[model samples]
Target chain A: MPGDAWSRWRAFAFFAVLLVAIAVLFAGASALYRVPPAAVVHDVHLRVEGPGWTIEYRADTTPNSTAYAILAEAADRLGFVLDARRYVAPLDSVLVESINGTRNGEDGLWWLYWVDGAYGDVGADRKALHDGSDVLWAFREYPPREASP
Target chain B: MNVRSFSLRPHKRGKVPPWKLALLLIAAGVLGRLVLWEMPNVEPVMAVALIAGMLLGGYYVILVPVAVMVGTDVLTYALGWSGAYSPVQILGLGAFVYSGFVLAAAIGQAYRPRLLFRTRTIAVMARISIPATILFDLWTAFGDWLAISRHPPMNWSLGQVLEMQVPFTLVHLASSLIFVPIFGTLFLYLHTHGWPMAGPSPSGTDDSGPE
Candidate 1:
């Protein structure tokens, strides 16, 4: 019945809202940098905390693909092999939040902040960051080191 | 003598119609594409296709993925995901996968796509994976290279471009492995359980349209 069609329409609308909300959330939470005025970024800082010593290093400058593009780029770059079930958004959030959020919560001791050296924060808008800003990445684990010798 | 008079038969009400399954699966395919961004980061279209695969089986896998790609790609460009990897390049990725998906659909049609763990099964999956991944990956990576090289300031070279691919490829592989099975298994299970809205055959084949 045409009247019964409303039910289906409502369902579609409900999901449609959900989809939009998610898009908005990602839009809201992604790491960002401004172009032209700031233009190029040159450095990011990585920090690792564990056991006894805290280590920090500067990473080379790079441009991020924004929040939406992170997932596609991340899995390809970082070799992340988890079951996303084709749902990159949720995982992407988990990833971005992991990279973007504070390195502490209730215990105030478990988290990572910033990203790939560019100062990253979920609270920061892409348009706000300037070039050469330090991105702070924090980890509880000992940071992996590439063997050069 | 009375025993000879009666033969017992079980009561049956109604057999569900095929159109119901078709409409339902089609809707699911559409919905999957619509909600595809919710899925983890694989190519958005692949997410759509995977969900559709989980819904209607591998038959319309390509179409479903393409649908999500169309939507997200539109949104992305509108949001200024432009430059060298502009809309054309993004769509090119879709075009590239079409041939592969068509092949996949045909294979799906021929085989019952049982959740078999035979060597052949793994090989079949890998065969589908290898080409499909490469096909989609090249379009995207090429776009990335173009964007970087064409950026008047730094015209990067082939090695530099390829060198830059280290991280991207890793992520793609991760996303694909993650989604493909979780989805493929879900569809297999639904078909196996004789889901009321599932396992509809169009003629002799197991199109198994969802409901």
Candidate 2:
């Protein structure tokens, strides 16, 4: 009986050590791959397309500019309305609800963005810009959940 | 009577029949997942899985969690909460999440307590919950990485994955810590009292006594 108890305790200790190791690894990864703060002005290509209208522009912004900031700047340069709001988790970030007076889910249409062609999982405000990055915001019918941003 | 033939039946009795217990657990898990679908990461299913494993033992430890996951996922897909993943993606993600829960329940089964809800029992559950939650988070995060890697524009890196996973993992851990002891204690009382069974047998039927 004592031996059994000892073995159980040993097993518990092993798992405990394992969990601690993972926690350490996670922290280390975060620190090591931390997104560097933006340095120097970044040249970003921006495209905004919606039903019956398409706009293209280029903007030079300070380093560390977020996707949302870039979008807002592009909208300003093109004289269009950009509507956005802050959302809570599991989407704890800025959400662009509408752009150029086109509303999200308006007639089965929603605002979706892609950074360099891949769907952005993190919110616009959270996605940091890199120099020469292509940010595309399209107002299109929402895709199936499989591919929807 | 042949000893082998007699051994086929469950000679050791439980407050509830194992099959029925497994069903009830699956029902609870499905309901919890549905009601809490929008909440993301904060769900009672994990605690229920652990509790079921601890009390029910044997195959129920694994089947209960898997059934709950599959059942709830079907409902989530039907209800349009599948998050736009293709059926294949959903199945892939489900595989990872299901494996995590199964591993967690397996850990719970290792408790092998003679009596439920004792101080030592709760302590052991608490100890197991931490590592189990971490394991679950890591497994699902790997699933997330797999899905994200296919995307073209998204900057995919280990650091980004870790940073993105931190908040979700923390919430999951918190949910487990809160739910395990609470549900474990409540269900322990119910099982000891023969809840959903006829009545509490004054002479306990458990073969394993306090270690």
lDDT of each: 0.38, 0.67
Q: What docking class should model 2 receive?
A: incorrect
- Clashes (N, CA, C under 3 Å) per candidate: 21, 6
For model 1, what fraction of the real interface contacts is kept? Answer: 0.13
What proportion of true contacts does candidate 2 retain? 0.06
Q: Taking the candidates in order, what DockQ does each have?
A: 0.07, 0.13
Which 10-residue window of candidate 2 chain A scores lowest in summed lDDT? A27-36
Model 1 chain A worst lDDT run, 10 consecutive residues: A140-149
TM-scores of the models, in the given order? 0.38, 0.66
CA displacement after TM-score superposition, residue A17 of candidate 1 (Å): 38
Which tens-of-lDDT digit does each residue in B102-144 have in candidate 2? Answer: 8777766664456443545555675678777888888878876
| Model 1 residue A27 distance off true place after TM-score fit, in angstroms | 27
* Per-residue C-alpha lDDT of model 1 across residues B59-175, encoded as one tens digit per residue: 344454454445555665565432223335445544554544333333333332333322223234433443455555565556555643434223456566555444344445444
Residue B104 lDDT, candidate 1, scale 0-100: 37
Tens-digit lDDT string for candidate 1 (A72-131): 233345544212212243233333223322322223233333443422323222323344
True C-alpha contacts between chains kept, each model in order: 0.13, 0.06
